[model samples]
Target: MRSLVEAQISRIKRCIGERLLTQELASQEGEGVIIANLLNRWNAFGKPVCVKNA
Candidate 1:
């Protein structure tokens, strides 16, 4: 579980980048929300769908 979380954080850093570009706590929080949403969208697209064939 811990590794999964760490991997996610690493992915975000790699895809978006590390460090907040905006100053102030409020903007930083907003940035976090935005990054989270982007990550969700990216993960949704990257997920593999398994189709069963008989």
Candidate 2:
């Protein structure tokens, strides 16, 4: 569960960062969307989506 959360957080961070770099989204707005998506997925699943560590 921890791993899944971490992975999701990492991906969100990366996406927002890329968007920021491209000037496609303001940092705050990008982050807000990322959090919203993450929470939505978490709530929908009701369980951690585990990812295997590579």
Considering every candidate listed, which one attains the maximal TM-score?
1
Query: What's the TM-score of each model vs. the native?
Result: 0.61, 0.38
User: What residue runs in model 2 are displaced by over 4 Å at the alpha carbon?
Assistant: 1-25, 47-54
Minimum summed lDDT over a 10-residue window in model 2 is located at 15-24
lDDT values for all models:
0.88, 0.67
lDDT of 1 by residue, 11-53 (tens): 7788789998999999999999998898778888875789999
TM-score of 2: 0.38
In model 2, which residue pairs have backbone atoms overlapping below 3 Å? none
Best by lDDT: 1
CA lDDT, candidate 1, residue 46: 71
lDDT of 2 at 6: 86
What overall lDDT, based on C-alpha atoms, would model 1 receive against the true structure?
Answer: 0.88
What's every prediction's RMSD, in angstroms? 3.9, 6.9
